[model samples]
Target: MADVLSLKQSILIYLERSGGLERLAEDCEPYNDPQRTEAVYRFNVSVHPSDVMEVDPELGDCLLHDPLTATTLFQSACFQVIKSLSLIGKLQTESQVNVILNYTHLPPFPEYTLDLCRFPRVHRPVRPVSMEGLVIAITRVTKYTQGARFLCTNDDCPSAGGFHHIRVHTPGATESAVVRNDFSCTNCRSPLTEDVKFRVLGGEIISGQQRTSTSESHCFVFLTRTDELCNSMRIGRRYRLLGIPAHVHKWPNIACSVEANRVQPWNKVSASFQRLLRETSSSLWRFSAVVAHCFGLHVAPPGSYNTLKLSLLLSLMQTTTDAEDTFHNVDLLVVTTDTLIVDRFKGSET
Candidate 1:
């Protein structure tokens, strides 16, 4: 409780010092939707560190990193800042809010396909609609041009095996060469070829639910995040991902991915669950996990990774004070997207 309070105070202080609401408004200038923007403005502004902290290392230097704070307040500053703009409809795409770079005002990305719906209430497969979930499995991958092949020109070099990441002068080599990291081969003295680099995350999501003793049959939820943040996903953590229900490829091998355009931590339990008392949604079982991490108190050696995942899911399941002790079911979400045509109708009605 104290930490969260302190975090909120730090957030308020940071925003005020950085330029407050008006400057934030300037950051939002890209979003041109007038009516939606106005209603969003009426929504209150509040900051919770867990929901806003920037954990990715690449973004660490973008804001002040107060090493003194045990949690490293520096990491989350940029995320919270960008979130402030997003809340007021100042920015359209949450893919990569450019706070680290200079404040160039590119027009807001026109909102297109974001559809919000009700996440599953029970442990059953919801029909594949455009939805969001906390990422359970994801991996970061870098794309290199297959053109980065290098073969020694030596006739008797013993081993003329091809290599990767070497710099070679191409067929149309007129300009001075880029530094070749590989040494001149002792056998052939040949250089390797080079090209640009690309990186992204590829993974599947089972609607972002952990396994339970009586878990329901899960469906394929393929999502991809193409940026530095793709690697930031933690196994037990939660994320609010946005994607459409679209099929790819053809026939028997055909697969479906969410085609994610937005990703953020899903801190507030689902919309329906939010109506419950605070104790029901959070805190009831949070102490044990916090204590385990803070004090490094392992009750027992976790037998396997699956066991650990099951334990984490178990920890999140706390019953409400009600007679039935209703479960707050925070496992998944129904995503929402606004249509431009619908927005126009809404605008005309207003």
Candidate 2:
């Protein structure tokens, strides 16, 4: 005779060989429309070839794979949590429960097709519908875009093989926009190409649609200081940014000015700024600092935010003034109705 198992043991045994139960358990919940859920689940199950086919002759055949299996795991986890809540008498009236997902694999386009439903519950449904009285459904139908491709190209290098970032938006939205990096190869001195093939945790590339090609024609003028350390009084200390077309709009809130018909001022100002901020840091910091500056200008993607902030703050320490006056001694104060006062006073007494 086979040994009889308790509910917890049975749940554990069922999920032992599958994906880690703790992680999947965080996704479980009550299925209002089991029929629709099962319908979609079955389709998902059949499509995934990775699911187990024939289990041991003693145990029954498994039901799901890939996405279906993922959903089942979510359900299992939900059940355990809900049951625990009920045991403690903390499970209040029905509410559409959702787990906060910090999905690292979220695609650029939106996912999850929504459907309206009416159910009686204290909390709103995950996907809500416009129905009068009784239950309100505010169900959040989350869809996963696991196979979306992520391509990264150096923002400064257009000739380098880019566009690996191209991803197809599902359910007919806009074509995928390019999200490239400002990274360059220190060894080859070429733009480092980061494609979807390189994943964060697991190296996996997914299928994505392709878009047509066109040269950006945008001349990226890098305004970097000369490789020389000099006092603020030195003339060549300022570098110049050249080759940018005249017809460009400089960002409104930035200190840099933009010329739309000529690239002369653009070049001069860029050079001056670079020369003024020049320092004797290693090449690594120089490269990182430049990328960091792009992030400050909002020219780089969101990923550069933290790096830019940190790098810029550190770069301030390297500022070389003829009077050797560091910014550390300066107290920047802001007064009412737009006035910035940089007060630098020596210690003690009037």
Candidate 3:
């Protein structure tokens, strides 16, 4: 307890000295409106692990290994700073405020940075980890319990009337998993009933499979960040994600899922590939013909259906670079009655 308090104190000092408190205050200004009835306000704080290491090595290590506890302490420190700044009264009586620390700028931790295929063997539960893969699927936006208030059911209990036990959603926990009403009170040993009115909901995006190009291994990942951040991800795009790995219980077996803390789009084209493209820019037509001829030597004869093969290659390039908005998008509509040829082309494309 003493160490925790000291660590929290250190975090409070760091926030004050690093101008995190001032930024938090600025974030809360819009919520200060008396008529607003928001149940929760999330204040994102950008933190650089390198800076933290320079200031306090122990705290920095704690953030890397034990992120949940460290983030809780950071939240407590932010709340303390909020109260000291007299911004607490701006929120509703039942409102809960959260401080989200973004470690996006943190230098990669080599030991914890793992490949998708090695996830089953190398992953450490609840520890911060980083992985790179393509985003294959995404679910629609859903509501998750950010925080919930539970009241002791026993009327005669001393802790029943005055105090409310608040449960906040943590990484790896689901809304139903955290906000259930079967909790027993510590003071009176009474059942705690959830106060539905005080529940705070947040957006959730569940993405399926962080797949790699070289391996068949994959894992599920979900983003609990704000809606804007979650919605920014696109299918078929590769990304580097940093987060904690947790076991999700399936009926017969447990599967690993990453609770992504940060998502960054990764460039699929290698430096050598980019250089090759640049070198071939002047003789692009010749390069295209050569590439089409060599595209599928095993599935079809070389130089056969050169026009179709070149068109397919152009389609792929356009689709992959569509997000850049620099290239004109192409839509391919092949109208052919030759089923055998179509099948051969599809096999070659695959």
Q: Could you say which candidate leads in TM-score?
A: 3
Per-model TM-score, in order, reads 0.25, 0.19, 0.69
> Candidate 1, which segments miss by more than 4 Å at Cα?
1-130, 144-215, 248-255, 268-273, 276-350
Q: Tell how far residue 36 is off in model 1, in angstroms.
A: 38
Clashing pairs in 3: none
Worst 10 residues of 2 by lDDT: 38-47
Better of 1 and 2 by TM-score: 1
Q: Which of candidates 2 and 3 reaches a greater lDDT?
A: 3
lDDT of 1 by residue, 1-350 (tens): 23544554555564565454455556455445564322111111222222234432222221212212322242244436557545433432222222221111111222222232224322222111223344465444443111222345454553244232233211112113323446355565775333223111122222333322133433344444333344545666556554333433223422234434344554655754444444445667554443334331253344334335455555666544232444354542112375665556543422
TM-score of model number 3 = 0.69
Model 2 lDDT per residue over 35-82, tens place? 322111100111111222222211221221122223344334444655
Q: What is the lDDT of residue 132 in candidate 1?
A: 33
Error (Å) of candidate 1 at residue 228 is 3.5
Q: Rank the candidates by lDDT, best first.
A: 3, 1, 2
Worst 10 residues of 1 by lDDT: 38-47
Q: What is the C-alpha lDDT of each candidate?
A: 0.36, 0.28, 0.69
